[model samples]
Target chain A: MNDLMTRLELSALQDRYVSIIDNDRMEEWPTLFTEDCLYQIISKENEDLGLPAPIMHCDNARMLRDRVVALRNANIFEQPVYRHCLSGLEWTGDGADGYRCQTSYVVINTSAAGESTVFQAGRYLDHVVRTPDGLRFKSKRCVYDTSRVQTLLAYPI
Target chain B: MNDLMTRLELSALQDRYVSIIDNDRMEEWPTLFTEDCLYQIISKENEDLGLPAPIMHCDNARMLRDRVVALRNANIFEQPVYRHCLSGLEWTGDGADGYRCQTSYVVINTSAAGESTVFQAGRYLDHVVRTPDGLRFKSKRCVYDTSRVQTLLAYPI
Candidate 1:
């Protein structure tokens, strides 16, 4: 694991991660995290109510895999796609084996019928570590400030 | 002016700054920013469009004073008050004179008629520095992810 990754490398890392989702390679999504990692998508309304539930709460990579399985095999929804635009990737600190950084993101959802809308806008406070594969997320917390989500979040934000 | 402000100090600094707003001491608000500061309230829609306009844009400490003066002496609206709850205080880096941090905030509004609603939910991306008068913001970017602002944004977010 390389300890000295440039800012461009980090930005490219996230670009690849988002491409996985956008290209519908969801089962590979879990591979982006460490075996023991957290992935949660939180809403401000739930946060204000002091509720600790997430729209998608995957406590570990295994759970994330299960979510991907569900998304690919079970959950039913219209064909909507997510396109993420990220900015402000600022370094915060270095974790034990990785780096901690934050970035602002906007996710646009395009429906099967080709109607596109801004699905959500939020920030990603991520802990990333270089791995045999590449820069993998040790933990990824997606904090969405959007008060009301237009539709149920069927994909990992 | 101390350059060595601890994380707790930074957090408390922001808490105190917001308290001034909730307490209706608008005149004192300008003191929170440096003489040449940037303050703006931006919506996700506008941010996505790469628009330069802000709902409220105060380019410097003087503009902030004018805003406070207008708020106290001129602006007309039903008595709506704001209650802010901030979370996720993250230190991104040290600024030239002080530090840069980011925090997520939710604002609830209570009208004079005893009606309360969630006015906005957003994140504050700030550049703060210590000054002769304690901590002052060099720049304050309030990014609101709420789909729509319920009403006119008359006060500082």
Candidate 2:
């Protein structure tokens, strides 16, 4: 694909990923990733320090599915609506490894009581590859700025 | 222009807008809008209720320039840095009315002490038109989801 097309596709893919999560379509979430993928949410402090500690980590598609299953069944927490606002998409690399990209994101959570709060503010460091189906994530890392997490992060950011 | 190019241009325009604000280039802000333009920051609640109340509203370029002057010279408040994260840019209208566009935004405030916090979450509803100076906003409306204002909004988000 051409550069603009690639950007548009990648942008759409990012938007779709957030839309799925925000709209509670978790079951379809794993389909956007490769079978062997790494998805982690880590703090900027930990990441900058190379601590390797992540708030949540899933190494494979099955693990991602399992997390979704747990969220739907085993996990118990107050249900809130999530709205992700993303920006600053920049494609940094392209070649045999596909495309290395980064984008900024801010997620807002609204409680069942209708109180909206800024839940998380961060950036996504992504490695995306073109598949027969489309573009899927090979790896996605969320690095969040430290300020306040408010409460338990029951959902993927 | 083609749709993709138009989108690309608009996306860059949005990014530039934030960069100017985040980087404290207040003098150039009004230039992003047409000679006669409307800019307002309103809460989503009031927007949905059809109330015209806005935290800040500017009509015409002169008013925008005047606000910038006040912010730079007259306003007295905490000096915090702003970082805006934006996403989901969509063009909703075109033709003589210009391009009606929308994009989600989250502003993070970092105090001089280097403490970062999620300050405001909102979406920009913009109407952009092609002019001699490239593309400029004919109208820009910020509809914010307010659970907390934190403190005085000294700078434009």
Q: Which candidate has the highest DockQ of all?
A: 2
Cα lDDT tens digits for candidate 1, B1-157: 1222355577688888789888888887888889999999986557769987678888889999888887777767765688776554556466556788776666667888787755666667789887877778899999776656678788888
Q: Which whole-number lDDT from 0 to 100 does residue A60 have in model 1?
A: 89
Candidate 2 lDDT over B38-150, as tens digits, reads: 99998777887999998888889999898889898886787778988777676756546679887777677888888886677667889999898888999999987654567
> What TM-score does structure 1 among the candidates reach?
0.57
lDDT of 2 at A54: 93
TM-score of chain A of each: 0.88, 0.95
Q: What are the TM values for chain B, all candidates?
A: 0.90, 0.94
Retained native contacts per candidate, as fractions? 0.00, 0.20
Interface RMSD of each: 10.9, 3.6
Tens digits of per-residue lDDT, candidate 1, A1-157, equal 2333346557656765775675467877888899989898887677668799788788889888887777778777764556565678887555456788788887666554334456789988799887888778988988898978788777888
In terms of docking quality, model 1 is incorrect
Candidate 2, after superposition: displacement of residue B80 in Å?
A: 2.5
